[model samples]
Target: VTGSPGAVITLDTTAGVVFQLNPQTFPALDMAGADDIHLRNLSGSEFSTSVNLVADITTLADGVTPIGNNKYFNLVIWGGQNRTGQTSHLYCNLPIGQYGKQGDAIVDAEKFSVHTIPNDFRGVGFLIGELTFQFSSGGGGTWALIQERVLLGHFPILIPGGGTTTIISTFVDSSFEIFGNLDDTKRIAFQADSITTGTTRIITMADVNVDLADIATNNAKVSNVTHTGDVTGATALTLDLNNLGTETSIASGDFLAMVDITDSGSEKITFDNLQANIVKTGALNSGSITSGFGNIDIGSSTIDAGTIDGTAVTATTQLVSNIWKDINALDVKAEYTGSQTGHADFDGTDDSVSIADREEYDGTGVF
Candidate 1:
């Protein structure tokens, strides 16, 4: 059952309802790409960012109130899959959550993550299996699940891909394993000969990965911040990039965030330039700029602290962005005809470094 734009879906157990899906017409095999079930909620209240499919669900947040608003779930590869003796996972893409802002409309907790399948059953075939789910509130606790029988499918359509920065994220139970050779499951990928939005093809590496055993928060360009798991941090997958555009620097404070990680609080990677020409605002404020560290009320002198080690800065957490890291290995070579004017003004100042957030692997984990 898929709820389209302006559609409403409700689950009232008292109504004697059992949701059904189109059966697979192909051979029955575990994890085989056969028939799939799709359930989406374009407008269903009662649902929150997280849903617990372990119980009647009526007692968990939404009660019996509708719960799925702009949410979705997919039961893929529904056929002779022997998942009876194991557990499969379904990640939650509560992009806006119940707290998401639709166009200009606002709702508190409408994006329900946990969806009720009416009964503990799914698909139509001789190998149809039982389905169950649980909810997660990323604000705290464990929602990142891992090291088990998992079916990673049904990605959320909430990712805004039009702009320069495309955002896509999902929440899972604690200790979720992202890297490993799969056995009973296969990560089915959708291939696009020429993927484009409106009339333009996507191009560019916007941010860092969130689930690389580095932290739990979505990487919005962090360096070495440490966060051990949910509520604290997140892990991320590898970045899949190609033909992305290029960004260059050749002026003073041209790249904001050069040394200051403004989003994750006031975590600054400062640099001390003997020449006291300091900048205090904009993107190159912390890491991007090679010299300017932004000008602020620094004691009695608005000086240029542009030489301090600016390496300890970590990434800021984002809700709907997935984590993918850059590939940096020895012997990797590259070249670019950077614009002569594409650099931040050095102002003839030698810079010093000030690393922030104790390196994630430092002997002592202290910021």
Candidate 2:
């Protein structure tokens, strides 16, 4: 039967209607005017019919020249029928119009099936599919089933009210790039058994929740870190101070913060004990001089003192050992020599030295 363009033709073989056609003597059936031909069989008995569909490509201006060479035609079958208990075969004849290349020709085929369940089954409506690729080597080579993937279980579900659709699968071997921004409500979550084995490129990680175990191994890989809280540890943390700049001078009252090893607490200390701890070499500019409980050895340096025990001090060429004797004799003479205005002189034979009111010197004349 001939029909208009894009018309669907259905052959219902129910109610004991016999449809028969012989492939050997029947004429070629052209499918250029029809879009699809569906055969429906609702009867319990088998319906045997054979139809040879052909396309007349020789009617072109240059016969069989418009169709590309070295191309494989693909046949797709899609339906909503439950074929869980039935086994069927599909047969087709593909004519090779021309051959131009000497390489292998590959054909990629895909099948899609949708399964509908009851509403009480958690709304579990899913679509399951698989992809297959077949190749034929050389010209007019026998076609072979190169690979077949059977997708029996595991399907992706779609929500009803435009919610998030979740796909549960054991493994996914594909790459994806998402251009849409993800907020708090929209996010991707991986289970405990899930792992990303490849490199993931993320621009910013602000407001992203990451567990401590996720980055535990990558702690050493960080180049820099800034922390506002205190970082405490059970043991001591050693810091390398070799890169610190040198300090030229330290002020007098400035203190240093240090950890006291005695009590293991932080404390502040001044530079009071610096003189006894460090070796002195340079001249002191301006500071109070005090005894360091040791002998003072001024090596070739002059000791300029203003007064020594409230007495006028002077620089003398005498030795320091003999200068103490002169200092002792002058102390006694100042106590005995009273106010004598004139010199008392007498002859050497009967010379007597006396004072007018002193009786101790009158009886003891030794002239």
Candidate 3:
């Protein structure tokens, strides 16, 4: 019949034992020390008969309290025949059901039946001890069975190695395919070296689309780049002089990079062409005033000098000729004003003449 928690059920060759248990209505069951069945020695006439025992365990317990909902438990039955010295064990997991709720139609009920037969015509006894019930919650037993079946039938088993190595092995013969979309958090990271401090780059859908916003700092290192389109940004671009090649001298044919705002593209101009444009429209055509004297427009500027040497000065204009004439006239006046043998000296208001004699007027005169 009906047995409560920790109920003892004994079996004999001449009789049978039956237990009916409902885990939904019971508190908990712990038959560790009380559920062992002791078999009595069979008589000579009963040696050919077999003893049958049935047990129904519906609820599982941790200690004295029942715990779990929708749990699938494992039942392990182990025993031995002392007379025959034979030992064996049977293990089976329970089905998924709600064992915690009372009057639930999904409650799982398990029944186990054991048959004990005598070894021969001799009197033999059997002892079945230590009936253990292990329980797992949240369909753990079902998940374990699924995993086991997949491992037994799936292709390309996973082994312990690096992630790349594992992926190569998994798709050795076939291409790897993903059916769903991946976000930023789901990325493939790789590094050039195996050092711990090496730079690591992550590749995602944004990276494939060349989205600069999703790029990490110091991760985009390009050696050389050439673009025909305009490259514009909010801030000024700085070039590293140390990374560029040095040139001690430049030729007129040498080209320099420049942006063409008119065409909305990038272009290059030679040094000769650039210089010609500057000379045509620039204020100064030469580096020094002496070399570019013809092109210079002095325009009302005063010239201050200590001496204007006659040999160095050229009468290129009427102003220069007039200046020389004025200096020569002053020298002639100074000589005539000096004392002479016959020459007359005229003051502002009086005129005077000095003569030694009549001979002096002819040729030999001193005054």
* Top TM-score prediction, candidate number: 2
TM-score of 1: 0.15
Per-candidate TM-score against the hidden true structure: 0.15, 0.22, 0.19
Off by over 4 Å in 1: 1-68, 75-367
Each model's Cα RMSD:
30.7, 22.1, 24.3
lDDT of 3 by residue, 1-367 (tens): 1221122222212111212231111112223422332222212221121222223233332212332433323222222222222221111122222222121111111222122223441222222221222233433221111001111111111311110121222221111222225542343333345445765455456535465644445457744444455556654444432324344444443324343433223332222222221222223323434655365554696554333444233212112221222222232121122333233222222223342312221222221
Candidate 1: residue 28 lDDT (0-100) = 24
Model 3 residue 220 CA deviation in Å: 5.2
Off by over 4 Å in 3: 1-208, 211-220, 224-227, 243-254, 257-367
Q: How many backbone clashes does candidate 3 have?
A: 0
Report lDDT per candidate: 0.26, 0.28, 0.26
Q: Clash totals for all models, in order?
A: 81, 0, 0
lDDT of 1 by residue, 67-162 (tens): 243322221112222234332222122222221122111111122233232233344222122122222333221122111112223222321211
Enumerate residue pairs that collide in model 2. none
